[model samples]
Target chain A: MTYRDAINAALAEELERDERVFLLGEDVGLFGGAMAVTKGLYERFGERRVQDMPISESAIVGGTLGAVLTGLRPVAEIMFIDFVGVCMDQIVNQIAKVRYMLGGQVEVPLVIRTQGGGGKSYAAQHSQSLEAWFMHTPGLKVVIPSTPADAKGLLKSAIRDNNPVLFIEHKLLYNEKGEVPEGEHLVPLGQARVVREGSGLTIATYSRMVGLVQQAAEGLAAEGTEVEIVDLRTLTPLDEETMFASVRKTGRFLAVEEGHLTAGVGAELVARVTKNCFDYLDGPPERVAAQDRPIPCAPALEKATLPQVEDILTAARALVG
Target chain B: MPDMTVPPLPPETMRALLQGMMRVRAFEEAVHDLYQRKLLPGMSPHLSAGQEAVAAGVCLQLRPDDYMVTTHRGHGHSLLKGMDAQRMMAELCSKETGYCHGRGGTMHIASPEVGCLGANGIVGAGLPIAVGAGLSIQYRGTDQVCVAFFGDGASNQGTFHESVNLATARKLPVVFVCENNIYALSTNFARTGATPNVVDRARGYDIPGVTVDGMAVEGVYAATTTALERARSGQGPTLIEAKTYRYYGHGASDHRPYRTKEEEAQWRCSDAIQCYGDLLIERGVATAAERDDLSARAAAEAQAAVDFAVSSPDPDPARVGDYVFA
Candidate 1:
């Protein structure tokens, strides 16, 4: 099945399971969502459940937070993750802190689903990836899926989670094909999967970068350099054990992402691995991230600005002692 | 949903509502005097001097299970909604036994047991939360309703517009009680916008909206009961704009520099105590002696609350994280 269809399956399955689960965003209802992830939800689940909201980004987050705290689980879609700044207070302060502020008397089981990454050349405002902003908060859970199966499984888990989760999607990975299991199953948060096993070196990534890591692993293996690949589906309760185990096995690590280098999730992972497995490391961990600049609208500029398969290969080979 | 029927409530009901208003006015007066003596500390207490009717009337209609989300200028609302006066006062003093363990202080008082969601220091932030509470009531199929009491200043915030639209659209059971006390900190209503009446803004949401006499607790009581009945019956939301005023400065820190002395005097002349006493007599509800006795008793009650607050033990600073995450 396609990655977009699996997301659709998760939405349909969630709506079928709980009467309180609903969607609210611009063009979510009749238009079937901007990426068509919620295409049939509007027609099947009706407007109330798979809802359509105004272009008010701040209110959308606020309203979803309100809904989640009161009793319902509201999954709000911000057309693009770049516009998250519009609702920073609702996302950062209100939603994330409600559970903690009330002294844990309340729970905010909310999900903000938005498309991120800059491969589409959508330009400045529409193309920036800001997952790090959410990662900076204490009470938030950030999830990104590279395959359809992971999308469905992680979304199912996010729906049932009692904390506020930022369910991020990549613009380029939605249509990719992958094997998805049928029926209800959840991918637990803080669990990392070994997308491919190797022994010479380790490469860890998540979201769209998973494909790049896989390609880089294949190319490295052909050159007699075995690479252990790990996909950390969740960033918050990070699977530092799986990462550290893989790093200790290979004695070398390389982190990758589509976000900027300086404080990206990749940097955090590398810093933690370096600190935790300092003696086991064969070489210092290196991060290959997007250039720290606005994503230009031109296809060539956007392509060069983001980390590609060649960049991943180059960074991984450099990590080899 | 039940229809808005203006019922002639029991005579004691009006007396009860009026008494609540008097309690608020008297408490604020005491706080004002205490401020002059430099006793109160922390956030500037925004007195509910002329705006007592809204809280007293609306709280009178709420069931014990219903919830109320108050604003920064929320002493009247929190007190009238059954929050213990001693705890509230202690909180204002940042005492250990305060309503929020001193973290909330005046603007952030919260009581889960009494269904008072934390009073917000930020404007326009509580409306959506109240809507969420109402949604919970509806989703769980409970009889509870949530009332959000905001001010004229909060009415201009974006959350007000979004929450109101969402509430009316979903037909949620909630009340948007606005105390239109003429001023937003330092700016008056005329200085803000052309829509002089706050209720006029409610029409855009298509909810039943009204403006009532802020002086008469019965007027507010009657309106609040109608709105509550509509909400409890699953009808929808209502906007009640109580055109009241505050006699004291915005906070204990204010020197009354923005407004004139004559303006303050005009509003102070209609002190809720004097007006309610006159109303009870005019309606033949109570004798002059009884009213006098009630007034004295209320003063003593206020005194006891103040004593309890002053004598209450401070909280241990070590266990600050208690009840944070269960």
Candidate 2:
């Protein structure tokens, strides 16, 4: 199944399982989503369950929060991650702080699904990986799935989570295909998977960057340099055990991410590796990430702005050296 | 006797309305005294002293299962919705016995049992959430309605328009009540708003808009009842703007620098509680002795709540990290 198809299946199954679960977004119903990930959901679930919302981002998020408070599990889509800026108050202040502020009198069972990352040449506003913003927040759970299997499993788990979750999908990985388990395939949050194993170095990455790192690992293997790749599916409930264990075994760490280099998830990974496994490391950790600049629409400029396979190979080789 | 152009409500209903306004006045006066004495910590109390009738009128019409969301100046709304005055005072005092266990403090008290979604600190933030509550009621096919109480200031916020648009588009069962107390903090509503009245903006959405005399509890109550009936029957949302005034400054610290003493005196002459008391007596609903007795009881009730808040325990410092999730 394609990653898009896997997400679609997860939504379909969850909507069927829970009577309270509903989906609302811009163009999600009739247009089948801008990415076409929600194709045929409106017909299957009807207008009540699958609502088409106006371009009011604040109402979309705040309204979803109100629904969850009064007993309803709603999945709201922001169309693109860039559009999140329009309703940051709803997401940060209202949704994230409501439960804690209310002293746990209520649980915010909400999921905000949006597509992000650089690669589509969609320009500065449309193409950006902003997971680090949500990861910094205390109450939110951040999940980004790379594979079709992980996408399906993790999404189901996110839907059932009581706390509010920001489920980020990559524009580049929607068509990526893989084998998805048939029934009840659930990947618990805060668990990391070792996609590829090696002894010399460990590469920490997530979402679309995992593919780039894997391709880099293959190229490095031909040159007799072994690299282990850890795909961190969930960012907020970070599986430090898996990361620390891998870093301790390899004695080296390199983080590859599509977000900007400054204060990115890569920076957090490096700090954590240094703090926890300083004695186990042979040298300081390294990172390969997007350039600290607005992503231009030109294909070549966009490629140069983002972390590519070559960038990962260079960063990995230096870390392994 | 005063001119009785309209028939008076039953004596029992009239007494309830008068007492409701008196309770709000007493409770807010206690909050003011607590702040002055430095007993209440955290935020400076934004007392809804003079605007009691709006809360009493609108909230009295709501059932326990019906949802309501209010503004920063929301002690009146919380109390009218059946939240304990003692616990609310404790919350203002940041005690463990508070509604939010001292976590939410003055601006974020919420009781699910009473159907209060929350007391939002952000201006105009409650409207969209009210839209959501309406959506939940509609989605569940329940007869419940959600009322969103905001200020004339909040009507200028983008959420006000967006929320109203969505609610009307979906024909969600929500009532948008605007308490036009003429001020958004120190700035007068006229200085900030393009329109003279908040109800004028409702026409842009093509929904029914009603303006009521907020100083008169009966006016607010009648308008709210009509709105509630319209919402409960699935005719979509209605915007009710209650024209009123605030007796005190924006916050406790704010003195009367913006408005004139003449203006203050004019509003105080038409004080909601005092006027309602006279109206009750003139209409033969209650005697002067009975009205005085009600006022005294409200004062005693507010004093008892203050005592409860003062004696309540402070939250344990060790549990500060709790409630960040679940």
Candidate 3:
């Protein structure tokens, strides 16, 4: 199944499993979502459960937060992660802080599903990875799934979590097909999956970057450099144990991410490994991330700016050296 | 236009309305005193001393299951909607016994039991939330209506326009109540926009918009009653702009440098509590002595709440991370 199909399956299954679960966002109902992830949900759940909202991003988030406050579990889509800037106050201040600020009296069981990444050449306004922005927030749970099965499992988990969660889907990974589990599949959040195992080096990444790093690791293995790849399914409650264990075995670490290099998720991972697993390190930790600049619409510039397989291989080689 | 005639309510009902207004007034008065004593932390209190009638009128029409979202200056609305005074005072004092365990101070008090979703610190933020609650009610097939209490300044926010349009498009059960106190902090309402009245802007949303004398409790009650009826009957939302005024400045330390003393005196002459009390006595709903006694009781209740807040213990420092998640 494709990652898009897996997300749709998760939403459909959750909607069927719980009566309080509903979908609300722009083009979610009639247009079947901006990326067709919610295709046919309107017909299946009807218009009442599958709601189409206005172009207002603030209302989409604020409305979903409000619905969660009162007895409904709503999965709201922001279409793209770049557009989150329009509703930062609602996402950052209101949704992220509501549960904690309310002293746990109310549980904000809300899932904000948005797409990020820059390979499509959608220009500066549309294609920017902003996972670091949410990871910095205190009361939010940020999740970015790299594979079809993990996407399905992690989305289901995010919907079930009593706190608000930001479920980031990479736009580039939507068409990537893989074997997703058939029935009752649930991947517990805050748990990392070791996709590829090796003793030479540990390559940590998530979302679309995981695929690039895995490919790079395969190429590195051809050169006698066995690189282990760890896919962090969730970011905020980061699977530090799995990361630390992988780094301890490998004695070398390289963090890869599609977001900006400055204060990005890769920076956080590299910092964590340096802090906890310093004694086990064979060499200094390294990071492979996008350059500190907006993603341009030109394909060449965008590809150059984003972290590619070659960049990961270079970072892995440096860490091994 | 608002119906200025006294609502033909029973003597007990009228007395209750007067007492509700008095409670709001007394509560805010005590908040002013508490701030003066430096007991409350964070931002200074925004008192709703002259706007009690709007709170009494609108909240009295709501059932316990009906939801409400208020603005930063929302103490009056919360109190009238049945929020516990002790817990509210505790919240103002930043104690663990507060509504939000001292995390959400004055601007973020919320009580789902009382149907208050929360008090928003951002201008016009609660409008969409109220619309969402309205959508939830419609989805669940409930008769409950969600009331959004915003200031006139918030009416200028894009959220106000967006939420009203969505509520109208979906025909949701939500009432947009604009408490037009004529000032967004220092900026006067007239200086902010070309439209003279907030209700006039509701025409673009295709909803019924009405203006009521906010200082007159009966007028506000009558307007809100009609709006609630329309919402409960699935007639969609109504924008009711209450023409009110704030007797105090924007915050506790704000001296009235923006406006003249004469303009302040002009608004104070139509204070909601004083006018409502006079109306109650004139209509023979209650004797003057009875009205005075009710006011005194309200003051005593406010004092008791302050005492409870003062005696409440501070939150344990060890449990600071208790409510970050679920």
Scored by TM-score, the top model is: 3
Query: Which parts of model 1 are misplaced by more than 4 Å?
Result: B1-9, B23-49, B82-105, B111-115, B134-145, B206-208, B229-235, B287-326
* Tens digit of per-residue lDDT, candidate 1, span A1-321: 998999889989998999889888899999998999899998998877876776777667877765665568988899999888877877776777665555455677888899898787799898877888888887889998888999999998998888889999998888899999877768998899999998888888899999988888888989999989899998886889999999889999898888999899888988899999999998789998999888889999988898999998888877783
Order the candidates by TM-score, highest first.
3, 2, 1
Let me know the TM-score candidate 2 reaches against the reference structure. Answer: 0.98
What is candidate 2's CA lDDT for residue B149?
94
| Candidate 3 residue B100 C-alpha distance from true site, Å | 1.1
Predicted candidate 3 versus true structure: per-residue lDDT over A264-295, tens digit per residue? 98888999999999999988898889999889
Top model number, lDDT: 2
Q: Scored by Cα lDDT, where does model 3 land?
A: 0.91
The C-alpha local distance difference test score for the whole of candidate 1 amounts to: 0.81
Q: Estimate TM-scores for all models.
A: 0.88, 0.98, 0.99
lDDT of each: 0.81, 0.92, 0.91
Interface C-alpha RMSD per candidate, 1 decimal: 3.2, 0.7, 0.9
Sort the predicted structures by DockQ, highest score first.
2, 3, 1
Q: DockQ for each candidate?
A: 0.30, 0.86, 0.81
Error of 3 at A311 (Å): 0.9
Per-residue lDDT tens digits of candidate 2, residues B1-326? 11235465677877999999999999999999999999989778889999999999989879999999988989999899888999999999999999888999889988877998999899999989999999899999998999999998899999998999999999999999999999898889889898889999889999999998889998888888888988999999999999899898888878968899999999999999999999889988899999999999999999999999999999999999989987
lDDT of 1 by residue, B176-274 (tens): 998888888888888885598889997888889988877667778878888888888989999998888877667767777888898888877876668
Which DockQ-derived CAPRI band holds candidate 1?
Answer: acceptable
